[model samples]
Target: MSLELANYEAQAREAVKMFWGNREAALAKQVASGNQDAGTRGAVTAGKNMDGFLALAQSLVSANGLAMADIHVQRRVLTLPGFFRPTKLWDMLVIYRGQLVAALEFKSQVGPSFGNNFNNRSEEAIGTAHDLWTAYREGAFGEDSARPFLGWVMLVEDCPASRSAVRDTEPHFPVFPEFKGASYSTRYDLLCKKLVQEGLYTSAAFLSSPRTAAGDGAYTHLSELTSLKTFVTDFSAHIAAVAAR
Candidate 1:
């Protein structure tokens, strides 16, 4: 059977708009209240910036097949057992007939401090995937549960700082050729691809949009491998397959 992509491109554009709009609104609200946070913490603490993307994911689950699946978005019910830690909270979870269908993480990074934030995000992504997979292998879900689809989606601010090549100092060993002078955007693309390649995630997506994206919801994908299209297509297919069974 053909997979249903659920018209994700248009929905993703709207999601981008919502992402930027939310951040701006959050920042403005804090400033107006005379309680602005340090740096961008005000906007970050507001949360719900990625609700639009979460809605798109929910639509995909229902439109493609599992209309009745329990799509968990509430914070209280999103925890899953982890191997390295007690539990991990996912951004979204899909459960059907007592079986875990999918788990997804949606993340975004804004400018002025991409370097530190990028490193932190990378470590978190890698650790989260490793912990989950290890738990899965140990029957954290169920003894006979099918492998659930794990996905990661990232949104970054597009600007000269994020796109410009970065220099790295290697004292003893040389860095990989591909990463020798990779920009923050390129590094994200590489991270997404490697996550999938190493089976850390079933699929990963990397997106970039300028602050102006709040107006038109314009976004860019670095590569087909890590594009939102590929991410949703693969996810839709997985959901469809599980529904068929």
Candidate 2:
């Protein structure tokens, strides 16, 4: 791996460790003390433990030497106007030279409830991209010469619940053949691939790390297209070319 990418890999482990830390802290704080809404469990169940994704984003932007002023990770600052919806909050946003440079979303799913959350995650991902593209086509960001870079990074827990076959029931008609007997991991892989294939995203990374070993950034990647290495490489190349000009 390139030096910059090597650094990202090392730092990815930090994200994993931070994820666990945040989870444990939230639970501990609520249990030890008397706090009801302290932990991250929610109706939507997104952004439960985001430290790892944030770290991943920080490493990427810093590696590219992006100015701190040009980046926004806060919810208020990251919200952008949309065509389908009024506005949507993004995980990370970068604007430079009066143009939207990039927008990224990070999502993760833990085990024991993969079946319930799979479709929700997919719909959210697709709808978010569709809304952004339509908004961009309608000049939501501005009259930039080119489209902004859109990225997605998903971290999935490596557990039996997520890896086992997910039963699919098609009541009226048949579903996609590839989806047959697919697990949560496989579904995510397909989702990332389709997002890029449809031009909904510039690149997408589907990463998996075990709860036990993710602290050291230990994970497995089987898909070449959606690998974190591929995502980082592609993202770095885009940043490099844009910054050079």
Candidate 3:
């Protein structure tokens, strides 16, 4: 089976709709009017909007020989064993005959909060990888023989706030050369590429979409190294190999 991108434009638009819907619902129900939390808290409410991408991911698993029953998307069974933590909920997971096949995390970033969330996002991504790999090293996934494929996808909103250059202030020591004047978008692209280079993830994708026209399914890749095409190509190869075995 071949790896082909699904109708991403429709899915992306759905994600945007979900994001705004969740945030608006939260604002109406969760926080006090005119409070600082009211505006910002809603931003975190609709994170699951990106779950549509998981459907595309599921396609990869299905194409690779795993059946629908083998893949888990619901949070209940999506929990995977962790080293530092008892367990972590993953966005998507595939298991075949008690052997771990793949686990992926889908994440997104939207504007007005990029600055406040970038560091947290970075730490979360790295820490999750560390926990999973360490757990695998300790034989966390039962008697599984081969390593499980780990994937990360970052969908950032394409807006002025995210694309503008950001200043770096290194008070104590010098920051990395790549991030000296990188914008949030560029920083995320670097993060995706570096995660693969550092062997933290099997494949990673960096995507940008605009909220208003997301339904048009328009998204941009920051670089070839971190592009979704590359991620899918690598992941397809891995999954195809695993299925063959």
lDDT of 1 by residue, 65-139 (tens): 799999999999999999999999999999999989999999999887888899999999999999999999999
Backbone clashes in model 3? 1
* Prediction RMSDs, each to the true structure: 1.3, 2.6, 3.1
lDDT of 1: 0.93
Best by TM-score: 1
- The per-residue C-alpha lDDT of model 1 at residue 93 equals 99
> Which stretches in model 3 have alpha-carbon errors above 4 Å?
1-37
**Residue 160 shift from truth in candidate 3, angstroms:** 1.2
Candidates in order, TM-scores: namely 0.97, 0.90, 0.86
Comparison by TM-score, 1 against 3, better one:
1
**Residue-level lDDT tens digits of model 3 in 143-206:** 5469889999998888999999999778999998899878999999999988999999999999
For residues 127-232, write the lDDT of model 2, one tens digit per residue: 9999999999988887764678899998888988878987788899988998999888999999999999998899998988787863465777759999888888
| Cα TM-score of candidate 2 | 0.90
Q: Give the worst 10-residue stretch by lDDT in candidate 3.
A: 3-12
